[model samples]
Target: MTSAALSVNIWSIPTTTAGTTRFTSKNGHTLDYRIHSGIVGNRWVKDQEAYIVRVGESIYKISWTEPTGTDVSLIVNLGDKLFHGTIFFPRWIMNNPEKTICFQNDHIPLMNSYRDAGPAYPTEVIDEFATITFIRDCGADNDEVINCPASELPADFPANL
Candidate 1:
Protein backbone atom coordinates (compact mmCIF):
# COMPACT_ATOMS: atom_id res chain seq x y z
CA MET A 1 0.00 0.00 0.00
CA THR A 2 3.02 2.26 0.16
CA SER A 3 3.61 4.30 -2.99
CA ALA A 4 5.55 7.58 -3.44
CA ALA A 5 4.13 8.12 -6.91
CA LEU A 6 1.58 10.89 -6.43
CA SER A 7 -1.69 10.66 -8.37
CA VAL A 8 -3.02 14.16 -7.71
CA ASN A 9 -1.72 17.72 -7.73
CA ILE A 10 -1.75 18.13 -3.95
CA TRP A 11 -0.13 21.57 -4.13
CA SER A 12 -3.13 22.88 -6.03
CA ILE A 13 -4.97 22.50 -2.76
CA PRO A 14 -4.45 24.94 0.10
CA THR A 15 -3.10 24.11 3.53
CA THR A 16 -5.20 23.94 6.69
CA THR A 17 -4.11 23.93 10.34
CA ALA A 18 -5.52 21.90 13.20
CA GLY A 19 -5.13 22.02 16.98
CA THR A 20 -2.25 21.06 19.22
CA THR A 21 -1.42 17.34 19.39
CA ARG A 22 -0.28 15.55 22.52
CA PHE A 23 2.27 12.71 22.37
CA THR A 24 3.07 10.46 25.34
CA SER A 25 5.83 7.87 25.34
CA LYS A 26 5.72 4.41 26.88
CA ASN A 27 7.78 5.58 29.89
CA GLY A 28 5.11 8.19 30.79
CA HIS A 29 6.62 11.26 29.16
CA THR A 30 4.27 13.83 27.65
CA LEU A 31 4.98 16.34 24.84
CA ASP A 32 2.28 18.79 23.86
CA TYR A 33 1.84 20.68 20.58
CA ARG A 34 3.59 17.98 18.55
CA ILE A 35 3.98 20.34 15.54
CA HIS A 36 4.66 17.31 13.29
CA SER A 37 4.13 13.55 12.88
CA GLY A 38 4.62 11.11 9.96
CA ILE A 39 5.23 7.51 8.96
CA VAL A 40 8.74 6.12 8.47
CA GLY A 41 8.25 4.19 5.21
CA ASN A 42 5.74 6.27 3.28
CA ARG A 43 6.76 9.65 4.67
CA TRP A 44 9.70 11.11 6.56
CA VAL A 45 9.04 10.81 10.27
CA LYS A 46 10.48 13.96 11.85
CA ASP A 47 9.53 12.89 15.33
CA GLN A 48 11.91 10.09 16.39
CA GLU A 49 9.12 8.58 18.42
CA ALA A 50 7.29 7.93 15.14
CA TYR A 51 9.82 5.23 14.28
CA ILE A 52 9.70 3.64 17.73
CA VAL A 53 5.92 3.72 17.92
CA ARG A 54 5.64 2.07 14.49
CA VAL A 55 7.70 -0.98 15.43
CA GLY A 56 7.72 -1.95 19.11
CA GLU A 57 4.62 -3.63 20.46
CA SER A 58 5.24 -2.41 24.01
CA ILE A 59 5.30 1.25 22.93
CA TYR A 60 2.63 3.33 21.22
CA LYS A 61 2.36 7.07 20.50
CA ILE A 62 -1.02 8.67 20.02
CA SER A 63 -0.97 12.19 18.62
CA TRP A 64 -4.01 14.47 18.39
CA THR A 65 -2.53 17.57 16.73
CA GLU A 66 -5.66 18.10 14.69
CA PRO A 67 -6.23 21.38 16.55
CA THR A 68 -2.84 23.04 16.15
CA GLY A 69 -1.76 21.20 13.01
CA THR A 70 -3.48 19.36 10.18
CA ASP A 71 -2.39 15.79 10.96
CA VAL A 72 -3.44 13.32 13.64
CA SER A 73 -1.05 10.40 14.25
CA LEU A 74 -2.48 7.42 16.12
CA ILE A 75 -0.66 4.17 16.87
CA VAL A 76 -2.64 1.40 18.52
CA ASN A 77 -1.85 -2.25 19.25
CA LEU A 78 -5.29 -3.69 19.94
CA GLY A 79 -3.82 -6.85 21.46
CA ASP A 80 -2.28 -4.87 24.30
CA LYS A 81 -5.50 -2.97 24.70
CA LEU A 82 -3.43 -0.46 26.60
CA PHE A 83 -5.07 2.61 28.12
CA HIS A 84 -4.05 4.59 24.97
CA GLY A 85 -5.47 6.67 22.15
CA THR A 86 -9.10 7.21 23.11
CA ILE A 87 -8.72 6.73 26.86
CA PHE A 88 -5.14 8.12 27.19
CA PHE A 89 -6.82 11.36 28.41
CA PRO A 90 -4.25 14.13 27.91
CA ARG A 91 -4.76 17.51 29.62
CA TRP A 92 -6.49 19.39 26.77
CA ILE A 93 -9.05 16.71 25.90
CA MET A 94 -10.03 16.17 29.53
CA ASN A 95 -12.78 18.79 29.46
CA ASN A 96 -14.66 18.44 26.13
CA PRO A 97 -12.88 16.57 23.38
CA GLU A 98 -16.05 16.37 21.36
CA LYS A 99 -15.79 20.09 20.78
CA THR A 100 -12.55 19.47 18.89
CA ILE A 101 -12.92 19.32 15.14
CA CYS A 102 -11.17 20.62 11.92
CA PHE A 103 -12.69 22.34 8.94
CA GLN A 104 -11.90 22.12 5.14
CA ASN A 105 -13.63 24.14 2.47
CA ASP A 106 -12.89 26.75 -0.22
CA HIS A 107 -11.07 29.24 1.99
CA ILE A 108 -8.74 27.32 4.29
CA PRO A 109 -5.98 25.18 2.75
CA LEU A 110 -6.06 21.40 3.35
CA MET A 111 -2.44 20.29 3.29
CA ASN A 112 -1.70 17.00 5.08
CA SER A 113 -3.63 13.82 5.87
CA TYR A 114 -3.26 11.07 8.48
CA ARG A 115 -3.06 7.24 8.62
CA ASP A 116 -6.48 6.62 10.15
CA ALA A 117 -8.59 8.52 12.62
CA GLY A 118 -12.16 9.85 12.60
CA PRO A 119 -14.25 11.55 9.95
CA ALA A 120 -13.47 15.09 8.85
CA TYR A 121 -15.70 18.04 9.81
CA PRO A 122 -18.67 18.37 7.51
CA THR A 123 -22.22 19.58 7.88
CA GLU A 124 -23.59 16.91 5.54
CA VAL A 125 -21.27 14.34 3.99
CA ILE A 126 -21.08 14.91 0.26
CA ASP A 127 -20.21 12.42 -2.47
CA GLU A 128 -18.53 14.89 -4.81
CA PHE A 129 -14.83 15.83 -4.91
CA ALA A 130 -15.57 19.45 -5.73
CA THR A 131 -14.33 20.51 -2.30
CA ILE A 132 -11.09 19.62 -0.50
CA THR A 133 -12.29 17.06 2.05
CA PHE A 134 -9.37 16.23 4.33
CA ILE A 135 -8.54 12.58 4.80
CA ARG A 136 -8.97 10.44 7.86
CA ASP A 137 -5.16 9.97 7.43
CA CYS A 138 -2.90 12.46 5.60
CA GLY A 139 0.83 12.67 4.86
CA ALA A 140 3.55 13.25 2.24
CA ASP A 141 7.19 12.27 1.76
CA ASN A 142 8.26 15.89 1.27
CA ASP A 143 8.66 17.84 4.51
CA GLU A 144 7.72 21.14 2.91
CA VAL A 145 4.41 19.70 1.72
CA ILE A 146 2.24 18.73 4.65
CA ASN A 147 -0.26 16.14 3.30
CA CYS A 148 0.10 14.94 -0.28
CA PRO A 149 -3.17 13.05 -0.57
CA ALA A 150 -0.85 10.24 -1.69
CA SER A 151 -1.85 10.90 -5.32
CA GLU A 152 -3.45 7.49 -5.88
CA LEU A 153 -6.01 8.40 -3.22
CA PRO A 154 -9.58 8.90 -4.40
CA ALA A 155 -11.10 12.35 -4.41
CA ASP A 156 -14.06 11.17 -2.32
CA PHE A 157 -11.67 11.22 0.65
CA PRO A 158 -13.06 8.37 2.74
CA ALA A 159 -16.46 9.42 4.01
CA ASN A 160 -17.02 5.80 5.06
CA LEU A 161 -13.34 4.69 5.17
Candidate 2:
Protein backbone atom coordinates (compact mmCIF):
# COMPACT_ATOMS: atom_id res chain seq x y z
CA MET A 1 0.00 0.00 0.00
CA THR A 2 1.09 3.55 -0.70
CA SER A 3 2.10 5.73 2.23
CA ALA A 4 -0.77 7.95 3.34
CA ALA A 5 -0.60 11.73 3.35
CA LEU A 6 -0.36 13.50 6.71
CA SER A 7 -0.33 17.16 7.58
CA VAL A 8 2.03 17.32 10.52
CA ASN A 9 1.24 19.53 13.49
CA ILE A 10 3.61 21.70 15.52
CA TRP A 11 2.68 20.26 18.91
CA SER A 12 3.95 16.71 18.28
CA ILE A 13 7.66 17.37 18.17
CA PRO A 14 10.31 15.30 19.92
CA THR A 15 13.08 17.14 21.70
CA THR A 16 15.35 14.55 23.37
CA THR A 17 13.34 11.35 23.55
CA ALA A 18 12.72 8.50 21.14
CA GLY A 19 8.96 8.12 21.64
CA THR A 20 8.47 11.86 22.03
CA THR A 21 7.84 14.76 19.64
CA ARG A 22 6.05 18.10 19.06
CA PHE A 23 4.09 19.67 16.17
CA THR A 24 2.38 22.94 15.34
CA SER A 25 -0.58 23.32 13.01
CA LYS A 26 -0.94 25.76 10.11
CA ASN A 27 -2.35 28.07 12.69
CA GLY A 28 -0.41 28.84 15.88
CA HIS A 29 -1.87 25.71 17.49
CA THR A 30 0.71 23.59 19.25
CA LEU A 31 0.63 20.13 20.86
CA ASP A 32 3.06 17.98 22.82
CA TYR A 33 2.98 14.22 22.07
CA ARG A 34 4.91 11.10 23.07
CA ILE A 35 4.84 7.50 21.81
CA HIS A 36 6.80 4.24 22.09
CA SER A 37 8.50 2.98 18.98
CA GLY A 38 12.07 1.93 18.09
CA ILE A 39 11.91 3.10 14.49
CA VAL A 40 13.02 6.69 14.07
CA GLY A 41 12.94 7.37 10.31
CA ASN A 42 9.38 6.12 9.93
CA ARG A 43 7.70 9.52 9.71
CA TRP A 44 5.56 11.46 7.21
CA VAL A 45 5.08 15.06 6.09
CA LYS A 46 2.65 16.87 3.85
CA ASP A 47 2.47 20.47 2.54
CA GLN A 48 5.80 21.39 4.15
CA GLU A 49 4.68 20.27 7.63
CA ALA A 50 6.25 17.58 9.85
CA TYR A 51 5.60 15.41 12.96
CA ILE A 52 6.11 11.95 14.46
CA VAL A 53 3.59 9.11 14.97
CA ARG A 54 4.64 6.35 17.37
CA VAL A 55 2.90 3.31 18.86
CA GLY A 56 2.67 4.58 22.44
CA GLU A 57 1.48 7.49 24.53
CA SER A 58 2.62 11.05 23.77
CA ILE A 59 2.14 14.62 25.08
CA TYR A 60 1.28 17.96 23.45
CA LYS A 61 0.53 21.65 24.06
CA ILE A 62 -1.70 22.76 21.19
CA SER A 63 -2.21 26.34 20.05
CA TRP A 64 -4.63 27.87 17.51
CA THR A 65 -2.44 30.23 15.55
CA GLU A 66 -0.67 29.70 12.28
CA PRO A 67 3.06 30.33 12.28
CA THR A 68 2.73 32.48 9.14
CA GLY A 69 -0.78 33.83 8.84
CA THR A 70 -3.98 34.10 10.82
CA ASP A 71 -5.24 30.83 9.33
CA VAL A 72 -4.26 27.47 10.79
CA SER A 73 -4.81 23.89 9.68
CA LEU A 74 -4.14 20.32 10.84
CA ILE A 75 -4.30 17.06 8.86
CA VAL A 76 -4.40 13.41 9.87
CA ASN A 77 -4.65 10.09 8.04
CA LEU A 78 -6.69 7.24 9.51
CA GLY A 79 -5.16 4.45 7.48
CA ASP A 80 -7.40 3.30 4.60
CA LYS A 81 -10.51 4.75 6.15
CA LEU A 82 -9.95 8.49 6.52
CA PHE A 83 -7.73 11.38 5.53
CA HIS A 84 -7.89 14.03 8.20
CA GLY A 85 -6.11 17.30 7.57
CA THR A 86 -6.47 18.76 11.03
CA ILE A 87 -5.45 15.82 13.23
CA PHE A 88 -3.35 13.65 11.01
CA PHE A 89 -1.90 10.36 12.21
CA PRO A 90 0.85 9.40 9.80
CA ARG A 91 0.85 5.77 10.78
CA TRP A 92 -2.05 3.37 11.30
CA ILE A 93 -2.95 -0.28 11.45
CA MET A 94 -6.07 -2.42 11.64
CA ASN A 95 -6.91 -3.27 15.22
CA ASN A 96 -8.94 -6.17 16.55
CA PRO A 97 -9.32 -6.50 20.31
CA GLU A 98 -11.30 -9.72 20.14
CA LYS A 99 -10.02 -11.25 16.98
CA THR A 100 -6.43 -10.55 15.83
CA ILE A 101 -7.53 -7.13 14.63
CA CYS A 102 -10.76 -5.20 14.56
CA PHE A 103 -12.72 -5.52 11.35
CA GLN A 104 -15.84 -3.81 10.05
CA ASN A 105 -18.57 -5.18 7.82
CA ASP A 106 -20.84 -2.16 7.84
CA HIS A 107 -21.03 1.58 8.44
CA ILE A 108 -19.68 2.84 11.73
CA PRO A 109 -19.64 6.32 13.19
CA LEU A 110 -16.66 7.80 14.93
CA MET A 111 -16.15 10.98 16.96
CA ASN A 112 -16.17 13.63 14.21
CA SER A 113 -17.25 11.47 11.31
CA TYR A 114 -18.97 8.24 10.27
CA ARG A 115 -18.11 5.46 7.88
CA ASP A 116 -20.71 3.85 5.66
CA ALA A 117 -18.47 0.84 5.21
CA GLY A 118 -16.04 -1.26 7.27
CA PRO A 119 -16.77 -3.84 9.93
CA ALA A 120 -16.31 -1.30 12.70
CA TYR A 121 -15.51 2.39 12.98
CA PRO A 122 -12.86 4.25 14.95
CA THR A 123 -12.16 7.86 15.75
CA GLU A 124 -9.50 9.52 17.85
CA VAL A 125 -8.22 6.79 20.17
CA ILE A 126 -5.44 8.62 21.97
CA ASP A 127 -5.90 8.38 25.74
CA GLU A 128 -2.90 9.78 27.65
CA PHE A 129 -3.53 13.50 27.84
CA ALA A 130 -2.52 16.02 30.51
CA THR A 131 -4.77 18.63 28.94
CA ILE A 132 -7.13 18.94 25.97
CA THR A 133 -8.36 22.31 24.72
CA PHE A 134 -9.93 23.83 21.62
CA ILE A 135 -9.78 27.39 20.35
CA ARG A 136 -10.91 29.15 17.18
CA ASP A 137 -9.86 32.51 15.76
CA CYS A 138 -12.13 34.42 13.33
CA GLY A 139 -9.35 36.68 12.03
CA ALA A 140 -9.51 39.05 15.01
CA ASP A 141 -6.21 37.88 16.47
CA ASN A 142 -8.34 36.52 19.28
CA ASP A 143 -9.08 32.86 19.76
CA GLU A 144 -12.64 31.73 20.49
CA VAL A 145 -13.25 28.56 22.44
CA ILE A 146 -14.73 25.81 20.35
CA ASN A 147 -15.07 22.04 20.44
CA CYS A 148 -14.03 20.22 17.30
CA PRO A 149 -15.24 16.66 16.91
CA ALA A 150 -12.75 13.92 16.19
CA SER A 151 -12.66 12.10 12.85
CA GLU A 152 -13.76 8.50 12.33
CA LEU A 153 -11.75 5.69 10.77
CA PRO A 154 -13.09 2.19 10.46
CA ALA A 155 -11.92 -1.18 9.19
CA ASP A 156 -14.24 -2.32 6.43
CA PHE A 157 -14.84 -5.32 4.20
CA PRO A 158 -12.88 -6.15 1.05
CA ALA A 159 -14.60 -3.29 -0.72
CA ASN A 160 -12.86 0.10 -0.50
CA LEU A 161 -14.60 2.24 2.06
Give the best candidate by TM-score.
2
Highest lDDT among the candidates is held by which one?
1
Count residue pairs with overlapping backbones in model 1.
Answer: 20
Clashes of each: 20, 54
For model 1, the superposed segments whose C-alpha errors exceed 4 Å read 1-52, 67-75, 86-161
Residue-level lDDT of model 1, residues 1-161, one tens digit each, is: 12122222121111222222222232222221122222111221222222223335333434433321333444434234332222222333323233222222221232122212323332121111112333222232333233222333345633334
Model 2 C-alpha lDDT per residue in residues 72-160, reported as the tens digit of each score: 23332222221222331212222322121111212122311321222333432232222112122223111121111111212341122
**TM-score of structure candidate 1:** 0.21
